[model samples]
Target: MGANIGDNLFSIFNSMTEYMIDAGQRSVLYWDIMRRRGNQYLEHMAKNIPDVLKFDYELLINGRSLPEPVNYGLLKILPPKGVAIDNRKRPFVVIDPRAGHGPGIAGFKADSEIGVALSEGYPCYFIGFTPMPEPNQTIEAVIRGEAHFLAHVNELHPKADGKPVVIGNCQAGWAVMLLAATRPELCGPIIVAGAPLSYWEGVHGQNPMRYTGGMMGGSWMAALLSDLGHGNFDGAWLVQNFEGLNPANTLWKKQYNLYSRIDTEAKRYLEFECWWGDHVFLSAAEIQYIVDNLFLGNKLSGSEIVTSDNISVDLRKISSPIVCFCSKGDDITPPQQALGWILDLYQSVDDIYASNQTIVYCVHEHTGHLGIFVSSNVARKEYFEFASNIDLIDCLPPGLYEAVIEKINYDTVNPDLVTGNYISRFEKRTLDDIHSLGCNTLEDNRCFATVKRLSDVNYGLYRIMVQPMVRAMTTEENAKLMRRLHPLRLGYELLSDHNPMMKPLEWAAKWVSEHRQPVKPDNHFLQWQTLYSDLLATSLNIFRDWRDMMTEQMFFGIYSQDWLQALMGLRASDAPPRKHPGHDPVHLAFIEQRKKEILAGMDKGGPREALIRGFIYVRIPEGACDERGFEMIRRIRAEHHDNHLSEFKKTCREQFFMILLDARRAVEAIPQLLVGREEAGQKFFEIIRKVATAPGPLGKEADMRLAEIKALFIPVRPEQDEK
Candidate 1:
């Protein structure tokens, strides 16, 4: 009994010593993290002292500031290897979002937008800005600046494929869209990733971030804050808003995650923290324009916002093809917000077609908003496929399509036909298809319309009763102090190297890291620590969900009132139904004229024309199209083209539209295209057969379409092998 008691005491002492050592080590590491973070913040502040971009841009295009103006310039990005661009290759211009963060997140890394384009041999250019906007620089000026930049890019790549494929991330997405709408001739295929064009549209209960604006009153707060900043709104507020959306991430998981895997996660955590902490500021007018016109008023979808020159900024006017990359898991810019504009702009699929526009969308199942742009997996598959097929997308018959990317599998029938690790198929979609994702936004939009009305009233009252007094008391110096005091900013400042309190921490951290005593994974105490962390996170998440639900309920209860909605210019029953622009006589004449031309050319060019027509006919049912089939078309076009690649693309587009308008006549004219080229006709049949069977076995609808096409081309289908 005495021996056992003595043994227990010794065991207790040993355990206590181990606990103390591990605890000491952890405490030192915590201080180390804080110090490193502080140092990083200071470094970022030093670089942004001049507020110039730290991006390693090799070539600067001093944009001719045009009649209006811009303080920013465009630059060509040389890859890390510093390879000179092949001017003859297609030029890829990427515009990084000027939202809160510094530039180069899109390209500085190997797994990024610029990186993908560069690997594909495209001459890559990036549109980035300094920390400061030109005095009184409005959105209009920025748009004009971008237009001139594109013109310069076009001039620089005179021998390259048509025009630069412009890629815009987040805020840049909508900016590019506006630019494309205003100057469609300058853009090739415009890609908008994780951008919310229709802001008021969101799912109920799940997307509660939309309700916060209404619950807290409205844009008056934003306006007042902007006035405080003396015409510049600190972007730290925007980043703060982003943080609030996921408190668990910002408050707990982020720090705890770093703590739990400190040894392995240090480098990555710091890299991301650099981007997250480096906040950028916006002009007061800019944020107001964004909040009022885009977010609250939701005026963009209907072309309510006009250009400086009085042109109505209608999306339908943009003739360039557009590809929207959104994600279902993105709470900020949900698929509904990303794609709801299509429902707003067009009455039907026919309307989209009549407008002579090509809009394709790809909805990722589970990537978050940042992941849509920042994830390497997304860049590898979706972006890589997009870069490879921009030309095909550009030339696709004027219609709506959903570009679907799926992993290639050996089990997929004839997998050898797929050249890459993934296959992207441009399957045609319609307004109804998009509507299925989130058609419930109409009611939500009505509630937001009420909020917008309230904002105007509140803002007017603030201007009259409150603004003068607030402005009198606030100076630029005080405003700077206030911005620095922001919680996100203050945390870094408190933990910074400048703090005398953290002086001893440096020595302690160095010693602890050298003599680290990490807790064992299976330690009971460590397990308890993990359990406590999880319980805290879970409880917070539950509270968040409940809060979201209550907010959603309150929003509907307050704003759903008929009197409130009617007062806000909405109908008692519903908001105004989305409308497409009415077809003007001139537009109708253009369409009639194109139809007439297709009708006239029905019985024209031999085998190639008929073969192309056959292919188009088979794909009338959207599912009939596949990536491998398009790949086949690409090979045939390259092999068969006699002139510039553009000529072949144009020819195919014209022919495809002709067939789309009148499939029976287009198919009937098959023999006409095949006249005097029986050998070519046989080759065409083989190609179509390959296209139909590439992704998988043909379904009934496609098979029937293929059968009709095959019967028409039986004379061309070879009966025996050539000797």
Candidate 2:
């Protein structure tokens, strides 16, 4: 017993020794990472906040040089070694969200939107802004600057296949859509990832960020912050808000994760911090407009925003295809907020068609808000597939659809026809499908409506009574001082080499790296340390949930009060706060007129039109079309030098809507379209057959439809002589 006790004590001594050494090494490494992060932030700022995109770029059009000058600029990406760019293909323009962080999250790494586009041989452009905004720049000036950039890109790629494909990340998504809506002809296709279009739409228990404005009593606080800044709003305030959404991450897990895996995690942590820590600034007018028109008023989708020129902004006027990529795990921009615009803009699915717009959305199961645009897996699969099949999306019929990307496997049908490891399908959907995702109850909408009303009242009172005094007290020098003193910035400034207190850490970390002795994974103390970290994170998460619950309850309780709702001009009803005005007479009449025109031209074209019409008719029952079928069609079109993609797209749109108007009549008229072109009809029929079978066997409904089309293409037998 005495010997055993001595051995146990010895073991404990060795364990303690190992843990102390390991902890010392990890501490050195972790602080070194933080030190590097701080240095990178300082360097980034010194460099005027250069984009963190992995690729090289050259400035093409600087928005500051435009007639309506803004700080934004358009840069053309220079492809890396071994990558080829085909100017003849559609150019891709990526606009990163400038909400708080500096630009390049959209192209921060090799496996990103820009990388995927370049790999596919398309020229890519990035629209980024500098750290400082031009004096008195407004959102309208920014939009005008973007319009000029697109026009310049158009001129640069005059020989390209079509207009530039615009990709908007987060906040930029709404801005891009607004640009496309106002200048419909300038955009080819618009892709918005992790963007919130309907701010009030969210699940009750899960989404807590939407309650922030209400809790703060609205944009008045934002106004106060801007005033405190002497005009420019520091982006760190926005970054701080994002951090507040995940207390576990903000308070402990993020730093603990690095400390636990200090050796391997430093690189990635530093890279991300390079972007996250580099905060930018927005003009008071820009942030105010966003808070008012988008967050509080929720006016973008409602088409209630009128420009200084008296032109109303309407999303339905966008001639380009709109693709929305969102995630269920994204608390910042939940799927409901990302896709609820369809519900807000149109009363039904047919309204989408009548408006002649194509909207496709994809909801990822578990990616966070940043992962939607930053994760390599998503960049490889979703962004790659989107770039690969952009033309297909551009040509899809005017309506709502869900983008479904599936990995190819042994069970995948006709895998040979798929371009990549995944096959993309656009499944026809309805407003009901959008509703299926989730939405707030009418009471919830009314609560938010009250929040908006109260916000206006509060902001009005603050501006009237307190603004002059605050403005009188603040100056540009004070604003700059306050911005530098922000906690987010102060941390970096203190940890950087400029601080004498941290001067020893540089050498300490180097010495630790030289003599690093990592503890074994199964070490008892190390195991306990990990367990402690987990407990800390879990506790923080619990606190977060509790805080969110309280916040939500307080917001609803205050906003849903009868007197408050009455004061806000709201009542408890089945109707939502924001109601879609049913189709106007002018739009209804236009739909009828367009239908008559389509019916008149049912038999207008020859073999190309016949093939497209027949294909649409046969595939209509399936309710989805995959990349495999579209690839076959593209191959066939390639063989015919006379067929331009633009013409092919027009034929597709016309035939698709015609069939939507009257399927039987459109199918019957296929023979009429192929009349006097028997040989061509036969060839086109064979092409369609190959495409239809490329995705393996069709269903019974599709098979029957194909058979009907085959019969239409068959040559009529001459009457038997004197039978």
Candidate 3:
């Protein structure tokens, strides 16, 4: 009996071991299947990626052909239709960044910044460039070209109430701000999305990417790479750097997510990759200038940069209202980089106001750098809100504001759409609030200064010793081949059969589709798989955080320690004051004279007239005022018959619809209608302001008239001024 029991136990133990081995094999098979599924999805999506060669808009000039060459030797877009008929008060210009990417990202879809503007009846223009810039085209030339574009836009819409609104994305952000500051008269409000100005400012623990320059011995590598490219820097290198920042996403997570939900996420993956894959190149000079002046030197916001023609660029010189859109979650251009300049340039909030600058900023909680500009959800909320309330932003008092958009409900019967019910409020923000985000990190500044000195020494050595040899060794043909073989570029190019790996993927995809056992969205096994994936992603992020901390500490120890500083001849004192020649008495006099002239002009209208003009310029139409509506204004003026300000305003309120429907035509007809009431238009504004400012609500009739006037003018109240 004892022998029989022992044999039974041994048999059960063997059965258990076999079951364990089978489960382990199944898990391995599941992982393999998931990975293959992801690659297959990517392959299918790659095949459907839109070709970059199509033009979405028709271009026309009076003397040009029906289909003018889409390529302008730089870039082109399908010029948006309805621009001619749409109100030009809110002109939308989308400037795409030329940083390692081709054009059309700003209008890649129907739900982009361009699309939002088009839907709102704002005349939209896209600024794109060709694959190659003109040989002689310098940054200065581009700035001048942009100024010319805005000038042409102004001429096209002579009756527009306000100047053109320019929106710049990424690299284009600083470019547009530079143009606006240089030629402030040509533009109105300026919007910079995802642009970094104060490059050296970042949180202590968060942004280690900025340290890579110092750790890698500064921008000498960029120079070396450009030299190897034979006078042109392949933008693929910059794209590669971006990819290296997130290994898990670039290597596995991105593809795996697509594979696991290939049916649902395929379209989005392709849309993004279309823009990502279309890489462009920059002239060696252009790339060198950007790396040296903007990224490495941090000279833009510091007022240390000079244009090729010796013109100084200063952020404080820009008079137009500036709106900065940044994301806290953006690693490339964090909020600190976007907003640190405010504290760097000015000592106090009063200085900002004294400069007559209207600065507004909005921060999103968790959108990454790319999503800040390209995500559909971001476009719908942030871009849409900005587009709709741009006029309101323009009217905001000079100072800093944090724009907050709050959603509210409305009845369907309301004239405006339901989605439009959300109200946008501008809350005042203190300089301290902005400065709190590590703008006080002067230690980082010290380290970057050391980097600048080292980079200069390294670049000089490279130019003297290595650059000539590199140029001599690398021919244009070899450079082209090298570019084609670059890892980042190859990923896109390889899907073509020319790549051996692609052949198997093609066949494997077909076989899998034919014998597919796709899991449902809510399958138990799939849920477990997703849960495991999330845990893995979290683990990867934790590992990256730890690695970054170690890297940062090492960087600090090497460059920021006292021993290292002493060796480099570094001092703890702040950078020396900028040297400037004493102001020219003659130029100073001219500036004072201009200021006096402006004040005198304001005096001519008085506070009331100035206020009235401001209101009239921004007010929406009260009623259906078309071309023929001016007659009603004439009738009102005749009916009023008196020069009294109150009576003139009364007449205006009674005929609010006529003015609201068409202000341009009404303003033109005001002279004829006010033949007897010469001061009628000026008086009309004061009375409306009084009604708008009155403590209690106006009666129904009065309220209707007030609403009409409000529609015609965006109310600019003293209390609403940035505090």
What are the per-model C-alpha RMSD values against the true structure?
3.2, 1.7, 10.1
For candidate 1, the clash count comes to 2
lDDT by candidate, in order shown: 0.79, 0.89, 0.65
lDDT of 2 by residue, 30-52 (tens): 88778888888888888955779
Cα-based TM-score, every candidate: 0.92, 0.98, 0.74
lDDT of 3 by residue, 631-708 (tens): 223233356562243333423332332333344444334334334444444466555554233222334654565555
Off by over 4 Å in 3: 1-55, 59-87, 409-421, 500-516, 521-524, 563-569, 573-723
Please give the distance, in angstroms, between residue 561's alpha carbon in candidate 1 and its true position after superposition: 2.7
Task: At residue 26, give the lDDT of candidate 3.
Answer: 39
Please report how far candidate 3 places residue 210 from its true position, in Å: 1.3
How well does candidate 1 match the true structure in TM-score terms?
0.92
Q: Residue 65 error for model 1, in Å?
A: 4.9
Q: lDDT tens digits, residues 532-633, model 1?
A: 999999888888888788889998999889887777677855525444445568878998998898789889887767776777777666453566766766
- Candidate 3, position 662, lDDT: 47
CA lDDT for candidate 1: 0.79
The deviation in Å at residue 609 for candidate 2 is: 0.8
Off by over 4 Å in 2: 572-576, 582-584, 715-723
